[model samples]
Target: MTFRARLVGAALAGTLAAGASALAGASAASAQAEPCVQRIAVVNNAAFVMSFSVQASNGLETANTDTYPINQSRTIDLTTTALPVSADVRPVVDAVAGATRTPSSFVSYCENGQTATYSVTGTTYDYSVTLIG
Candidate 1:
């Protein structure tokens, strides 16, 4: 091939290689860009009253909790947001709860500004969370 043509070909190959690298880097970034998550666990195993369970907000929008009942149901507000499970929040909570829970009935809601509400009926408890768009 002519020298000028070869140079152009090399330039095009280099451009393509650079584009691929950039794309790969973006993919890696996206893979690592998942929302930071936090969790808390509450274990209720006695017939006596339990202390108030408090939730900590760190900019995450989702929350999960599991409860084991001893003698009563435990009501937990996972979030401190004032908007407590509005219409927009309902579907998200319902979808997550439906997919996560078994034949059990659980209550979840969004409070606002990175807070949620969760309750468990059992004596054991497991909790999880993630930030949603």
Candidate 2:
């Protein structure tokens, strides 16, 4: 081969190798950018059966809402491409005999692991809610 041809071939090979390396690096970075998963548990410590809804917002237009029964604990799994900074829990009070209570509401922020637990307390006349990591 001519010397000029050899030089051109070498330049093309080097360019191709550099491009492949860059693509491989980008793929690795994308693999490392896994979506985050958040776990939330709700427990009811009240006498009457409680119903509650959980909602998670993560900048995206989509929001997750689900209602679950209390007394028995419920675990909610929230998966999002971006981390969820906040969540809201709203309770619905059921009519109980001789009971006058208001539903409790809670707002919680994400922790390092994005795990939280909320509990419903108080009697039929009054309801209290708390959230903790």
Candidate 3:
């Protein structure tokens, strides 16, 4: 089922730790620190199928092998196979295989239990990743 994105999540204490911890804004000393263990909604509104993959500062990568159809949204569970860091959802496959799109969301944007929505819109030649909550 497609998970709905909400407006909750992410808190950093003091200075962020190094590496992936910094991206996640998590530190052992920070009492409000929380991992980004939540559902992510990938909404594809483009003209062709879209493939996505996630990369974290902690050297963790999850490649979504399935192609998402246009006008469809896929709910991905990051609670188990991922960390708390802000991640990059790269559009790896589409009509334009060599085109580039940079759209990212901070870990602090959504709470642990909340969902984050990353929508891809437009055609392959002029695609953009919508940074929505």
Candidate 4:
């Protein structure tokens, strides 16, 4: 090939290689920076209402206290919240007339793209919550 044509070809090849390298670097960085998504579902099997609160390790908190009816489930999305590696889930049941029942068991370590289910079940005035999955 002519010298001028060869030089231009080499320059174009170098530019393409540099661009490809930069694109690969950017893709790697973005993959590492992507946040995890957690899907949490709370099931109430008791006779009364139940409430729940979820807090991420990064101090992001989400709660649902709208009186979850019996035999129903509520799902919360924690993808937008800044969760570090785990999260804290607190559940309370309104089993009694003027009292609240707080479950001793809670959920931790919510994984990415996984669904965690918390089920609350018991007789009236004696409710319990446990992580089923």
* Per-model TM-score versus the true fold: 0.32, 0.40, 0.56, 0.52
Best by TM-score: 3
Writing each residue's lDDT as its tens digit, candidate 3 over 61-81 gives: 665647767888876566555
lDDT of 4: 0.63
Ranked by lDDT, the better of candidates 2 and 3 is 3
Which portions of model 4 miss their true places by more than 4 Å? 1-37, 56-60, 82-85, 88-106, 109-111
- Badly placed stretches (over 4 Å) of model 2 are 1-37, 56-71, 80-114
13-126: candidate 1 lDDT, tens digit per residue = 999999999999988555431222222233333332333333222222334433334443333343433433321222121222222322221223333333322332322233
lDDT (C-alpha, whole model) for all candidates: 0.36, 0.51, 0.56, 0.63
Instruction: Select the stronger candidate by lDDT from 1 and 4.
Output: 4
Of the two candidates 2 and 4, the one with more favorable TM-score, higher being better, is: 4
Point to the candidate with the largest lDDT.
Answer: 4
Which rank order by TM-score, best down to worst?
3, 4, 2, 1
For model 1, give the 10-residue run with minimal summed lDDT: 87-96
Q: Per-residue alpha-carbon lDDT of model 2 for 1-133, expressed as tens digits?
A: 9999999999999999999999999885554312222555667776656554444332232333343344666655544424355443332333244243333433443444555566767765676656644
Query: What's the lDDT for residue 51 in model 4?
Result: 67
